[model samples]
Target: MRVLVVGGEATIGRHVSAELRRRGHVVVTAGRSSGDVRVDVRHRDSVADMYREIGGVDAVVAPAAHGTTDRLQTLSRDELLQNMQGKLLGQVDLVLLGQHHAAAGASFTLTSGIFADEPWPGVTGGAMINAALHAFVRSAALELPRGMRVNVVSPTMVGDSVDSFSSTFPGMRPVPMDALVTGYLSVIEGERTGEVVRAYG
Candidate 1:
């Protein structure tokens, strides 16, 4: 299978990309500023451009999102919108536009986070966006045409980035990137749709 992994240069995305390659699947990586192709998911045009460049693929995995990390009190309206524009609408836009570019029976795996189910300080924006993605995946799955599938991966703090996030996610046992990648692979390779595969330790 040929797979396009957005944010493929990042920690989790890198793991997914590597594992897919090891399984003999052709992989293409895309990001805003890195990877085999560039895509700013916040904009529909950019997402469309990315699909045009890649042509069509059997799977599209997104392990990246852009959002603000400020407390609710300190978050401005613009900051809240920024998070929605990127993480929530960005991934949603990819699915909407990608339907036209993906092959029959194609699957889309999107990334959410533990914050959607568990709260932490200064992550209101992220939590909301994550939860929204989960809901989007569930509802979108029911409407997708031509055997398309949609799912979301909600992973806890990743072990590789524990140093940077441990303080924020106190008491949270960070899950290994390799383990989280497995959940993504299930969505990519399995027949499940509208599922929220949790990778929590």
Candidate 2:
């Protein structure tokens, strides 16, 4: 199978890409940096260009996004939009535009986080975007044509990176990146759609 993994430069995206490649699938990993192609999820044109370059693939996985980490009061409207633009809306656009370029029955797996259901002070933007993305996947699943599938993977902070987000993720259990990749593989290979698979819970 051919897979296009967006934001494959670091963290979960990197692991997901490597795992897919290890499984003997043809994987094209893309990020803002050098790759087979460049994709800024914030822009629809960039997503389109990536598909154009890769031609059609069997699946698209997005494991990267950006968002503000400030409290709601400190978050400017622009900061909120920045999160929505890159993480929420951009991934949505990826699916909407991807339908045109993906092979029939193609699968799309998006990334969300524990914030969708869990609460953390100073993480209002992430919470909002994560919840919205799950909603988008549910609705998109029903309307997608030609057996295409859409799903969201909501993972908790990685156990390996707990130190970097210690302040924000106080007391939260970090799931390993390898564990989270299981959710991605589930979405890609299973016949499921419209589901938000939580890696921790």
Candidate 3:
């Protein structure tokens, strides 16, 4: 499969990209600054441009974080909108515009987080956006044409990410990196749609 991974420069996206390539899939990593193509998923035009540049692919994986980490009360309106545009609407734009570029029955795998189900300080906005991604997958999957499918991977902080977010998840165990990667593989390589594939350690 020709897979496109937006934000494949670091963290989860990096791991996912490596695994896919190791499995013999043609993986293309894209971001605002680096990768086989340049794309900023927050903007529809950029996403459109990315698809145009790369032509069509069989799958698109977005294992990236683009949300603010501030308490809801303290978050300004601008911050909130930016988070929405960066996280929720950004991935949505991928699916919306990608339908025209991807091959038939193509799959879209998006990244959300454990916050959607479990709360943590200063993560209210992220939680909301994560939950919204789940909702979007459920509804969009039903309406997608040409057998296209959409799913979200809501994973707990894993491995290297533990140090950065451990404060928020007091007793939360960092999910194994392999488990999170597996969740994405199942969604992109398997037949499931509208599913929230979760990985927790």
Candidate 4:
């Protein structure tokens, strides 16, 4: 399988990329940083260029997005729109544009966080964007063509990055990065679509 993983330099993205490669699939990573493909999902032209460069892929997983932790009252219009543009509309457009670029039966897995339903204060942007993303995935699943499958991975705050925001999640399960990798694999390899695989409690 030729897999294109967006945001491949991030901690979870790196782990998922490595896991896919270990399974003997050829992995091509893309991000704003070092990658075979470079595209800021926030820009439509950049994303289109990325697909052109990669030509066709068996699967495309976007584990990259921009989200912020700010109280709703404190968030500026810029901050709120930034989250909506990148986390919600960015992936939505990616699917719309990428449909023609992916091979028949190709899979697309998007990233969301557990904050969608398990909300926390100061994370209103993340929570709203996450919920919208899941809804987008469910709708896209029904409309996508050519046997293409679309799903979202709503992972909890990962253990590796727990130090950054561990306090935000008091009793929530902090999933190991490895366990999240399995969820991505399930989306890619399984017969299911139109699903949000919650990789944590």
Candidate 3 per-residue lDDT over residues 174-195, each given as its tens digit:
8888888999999899999999
* Weakest 10 consecutive residues of candidate 3 by summed lDDT: 65-74
Q: Write the per-residue lDDT of candidate 2 for residues 122-180, one digit (tens) a residue.
A: 88889989999999999999999999999999988887688898677688888987888
- The models' CA-based lDDT, in order, is 0.90, 0.87, 0.89, 0.86
Give one digit per residue, the lDDT tens place, for model 1 in 67-108: 557977788878888778878888998899999999999999
Ranking by lDDT: 1, 3, 2, 4
Clashing pairs in 4: none
What lDDT does candidate 2 reach at residue 103? 95
Roughly what TM-score does model 1 have, to 2 decimal places? 0.96
Q: Which ten residues in a row have the lowest lDDT in candidate 1?
A: 64-73
lDDT of 1: 0.90
- Candidate 3 global lDDT: 0.89
| Residue-wise C-alpha lDDT for candidate 4, range 113-179, written one tens digit per residue | 8889886878888888899999989999998999999999998888788888677667667888788
